[model samples]
Target chain A: MERLLFDLSIAIERGKENETSPYPPDLKGKPGAYEFTSRLLEMNCPPDTILKQGMMPGMDRIGKKFADGIVFIPEILIAAKAMKAAMTLLKPYFDNGAVLRKGKVIIGTVAGDLHDIGKNIVCMVLEGAGWEVFDLGVDVTKEKFLASLNEHPESIICMSALLTTTMREMEKSVTTIKQAFPQTKIYLGGAPLTSDFADKIGADGYFPDPHSLSKHLTGNL
Target chain B: MINKTFRFSTESLLPDISLILIEMGYSIPLADHYLSDLINDTLQQVRKHTRVQAGFIMLPKDSIKTQSNILFENRLLFEPGSIIMSQLQNVTSLAVFLATLGSDFDLWIKFVQQIDMLQAFVIDTIGSLMVEKAVDLLEEQISMQAMIRAEKCTNRFSPGYCQWLVDEQHQLFHLLPADFDWVKLQPSCLMTPLKSISGIIGLGKNVIKIPYHCAFCDNKSCYRRLKNRKGQ
Candidate 1:
């Protein structure tokens, strides 16, 4: 069982979705995250344990490599793909309360910003790290954020913006959301964003990449 | 004003996979078959969804005007900050350019996002490179045309970079012809069809093309910065 878990972690780290996946040539033709996860489930391994041990570690490894600039988006993305394959089989367990996520996060590109690539990447990384993410998509206004917050109360908020002009919308949304949920942590990401700007705008954090954000979310940073 | 448009088939503007990989953060050689296959598959999809619509207009030197942040024709006030103004101060003319992979690419990316986020991301990166490549081709044509008149081209500058307020895109749009239909700017100045680029390139005898100016710009995550990163 431990060997299978270790194999699953390696599969997720290398982006092996299944036995036939041709990625990470070194691991090609081997049983992947999907198969290892299936085997773990058949052995009655708890879904939470599989997620915490088999999946998160792999994701955490890739995320750290990404933060360190040792791995890039393609690598992180493939790892996320492998993790998603495993998550598909475990979704039922999560829905049935057998598996628990780390926390809830609501994310979006601030109003007037149409770019979602960065926001989507963060959402995937957060989900892979076991956060239940609520994606608000692009051009999300303050009203929409508050509405979503009302629905998913106590959830952390993450906002993205690619344009300096649209950053004002982020500030407005941050101010509005903070007013309604003062304790709700809000994080910002984007090309134009900075830690100083995050501080200036009353945001809790600013992460340049998804890995750092995940680390902070998991209290590993 | 000299205005021209082009509609290149997707085959002509296909971005180099190596360059795309570099932009995606891979510094090593292209030995990863997974990314290779994905990029190939995505390029196939790109061919189906992309039709590059690009064009440019050149405004005469006298028609151009400037101040601290720079102004065009005593109209469009561009707050492009000192970095861009200092470079543009020597330009004899300005070439406003627009390029897009069209609505099909946007629609395809959205559709794929619902099914496969990884593919969507790959396609998004490729689309960015494609649009920039289209602009590069257009710039080449502009350069060739300008060379006939003994003029040179400087690096293109967009409103969202070099401290230029993105809202100035609205003003830039006004300088184009009424029927200039290659791309559209939203009320927020975010270009529609998503994978689109609009900007100004300096044209003159004294204007010199500054290489790798990303170091001078603050937008750390700019796509060009990643593409131009050392070893990439």
Candidate 2:
């Protein structure tokens, strides 16, 4: 096990952003993911190794914890924040193809739903797992989803709705997009949604949490 | 034609704001202190443009004649049901109100969305608590005014709850004074500032049970249920 990579993972897992960051207070004076990642890049460490070993494992652990109900939204949120700090350092490598992304994802909260917390968390974890995410934000419509998919032809769609009323829009978009692009997959999630509801609405998959979504993408894509 | 606006100070909300930190997994004393520091920093940044507004329109008892899908108010008629029938049976008039956490919160949400999602989530959680608390404070005033008249009323019932179709939000928005322009209702019936809330409270003869506030409700997202469960 690489010590530098291991340190980076610990920083992200415990949500240590930088040396000055007061969170995970036990680690107050220690270098955080930002410094560790930056230092690793300078040390000629492979960007892919840092992402695969340092970032992904930490995020995967937390995502699993999140799925198991051991860690709640706030904890997952803070961890995602830590992963993002390191991810910023790695983005240049992703662009230059030094470290390849797993694939592209289009995710959003559907139209008529203003809630973005669930959708945003999912996006962060997916991106941390090395996917290029196109976040469509809240109140996104089927046309926008479809258009985004066309732009990133390799992208899979993930729609989130936090309200029962807005969840119907998921079914509507699922029905419409499935008809037009029969092979394309659309995933559904949010508080009021269920796997049963997703199947009823013709969605290809259902994610109860972001880690599950990330796992599905890793295994499937 | 009674219209009023309110601004709730965040300082006055100190005690109640603990739940926001608690939900952020900061319940223990030391963690609570650390998270409180983080929250205050974010609150200061967010407060620069924080604009929370709550508006109310008090109507006379004779103003509303509700019929399942349609409500006849004065000379105007609007459709779809958000009006709780049981609550209306004993009231002299109803108070229709709207509360918004403002576009600045939305802007802050967007700002933090990219930079600091944890703070963004906390901000999101706090905005909700703030708007709901503001709404409750306003409702307390209405409840007291009704008490003075010796008239009891039901708990608020908003559109999109119970059998009330969300489409009726159009009708509810119609009842509010247009001069209360802090919040806007979209064609989709969703309000802007996203954290905004609107509902009707009937001045009647019975104490109505508020949904989500009930301990018996199985909803994990209900703040009251969470509060009661942990005694927060």
Candidate 3:
């Protein structure tokens, strides 16, 4: 069982989806995360164990590689693809309360900013790292964020803005959300964002990439 | 001279898969079959689905004024900075331009995101490259038009780049014709289609186009920084 779990982790880290998935040439035609996850479930393995051992390790490895710059966006994306394949099989378990996620994350692009690729990437990484994420989509107002937080209290708030012009909107939204929920932790990311900018906006954290945010959320930073 | 507009089909842009791959951080030789297929498929989708639109208006030689940090035209000013100002110093004229892949391209990306995240990313990257290619064509056209008058083109600079405050986009939009609706700038000054590029290019005998030096900028999350680092 341990060996199978380890193999599942490798499959995910290498971005092997299944026997037919041709990515990562060396892993082509090998049993992938999909198959490994199915087999683990058939063996009556606990859903939490499969997720914590088999999946989280893979996400952690890829996230570290991303932070270290050993890997790029495509690699992280493919790893995310594999992780999604596994997650699809584990959804029922998650829905039935057989597994517990680390925490909830509410992510969105601030108002006047239509960009979502960076935000989506963070959503995938956070979900892969065992967080339940509520994506509020593009051009989200502070009111929308507050409403979402009202639905999922104690959730970490993450905002993305790709344009410097829209950074003002982000600052406004952050201020409003913080005022409404003083205990909420707000994180910011995007091409034009920096830790200094986050600090100036009273955000709890800023990550240049999704992996750093994941690391921080997991308390590994 | 009247302001001009040009619309291009994807065929004219000649999207370069290899160049896009390089920008996506993949070496040509290392772009394996999967990546190659992925890029090719996305390119096809982009060609079939994207609406590549670009337009530019020329400001004649004497109508423009410049200070150390301000580009003054039509009694409006944009503070791009010392670096951009220095680059624009020798221009006899300026071309204010806008380019976009239109909203359909964005719709396709949003649709793909619901199904495949990696493919959606590829589509998004390709969409960006396509808009840039469209802008490149517009710049070349402006340069060609300038060449007829014995003028050369300087490297293009956008409001959100090279120390230019993004808020200046509002000022840049004001320079366009009132009827110009190819791209709409939001109240925040970001374009509506979201995958749009707007900027100015200088044309003159002494305005030489040089490689963009990312080292002088401090936008650490700038993808150009990664591309530059990769080149090193």
Off by over 4 Å in 2: A38-45, B7-10, B13-17, B25-33, B45-47, B62-92, B206-212, B215-232
Model 3 chain A lowest lDDT segment of ten: A212-221
User: What's the residue-level lDDT of B8 in candidate 3?
Assistant: 86
RMSD of each: 2.3, 3.5, 2.3
What TM value does chain B of candidate 1 have?
0.89
CA lDDT of B143 in candidate 1?
Answer: 92
- Candidate 1 chain A — worst ten consecutive residues by lDDT sum? A212-221
How does the DockQ of candidate 1 come out?
A: 0.60
How high is the TM-score of chain A in model 1?
Answer: 0.96
Query: Between 1 and 3, whose DockQ is larger?
Result: 3
Among the candidates, what TM-score does chain A have in each?
Answer: 0.96, 0.97, 0.96
TM-score for candidate 2: 0.86
For each candidate, the DockQ is 0.60, 0.46, 0.68
Clashing pairs in 2: B61-B92, B90-B204, B91-B203, B153-B204
**Tens digits of per-residue lDDT for model 2 on B158-210?**
77654456777877887787756657877667788787889887764454545
lDDT score for residue B96 of model 1: 86
lDDT of 3 by residue, B87-194 (tens): 777765777888888889878888898888778888877877778889989988888888886888888889878778878888788777544575788888888687
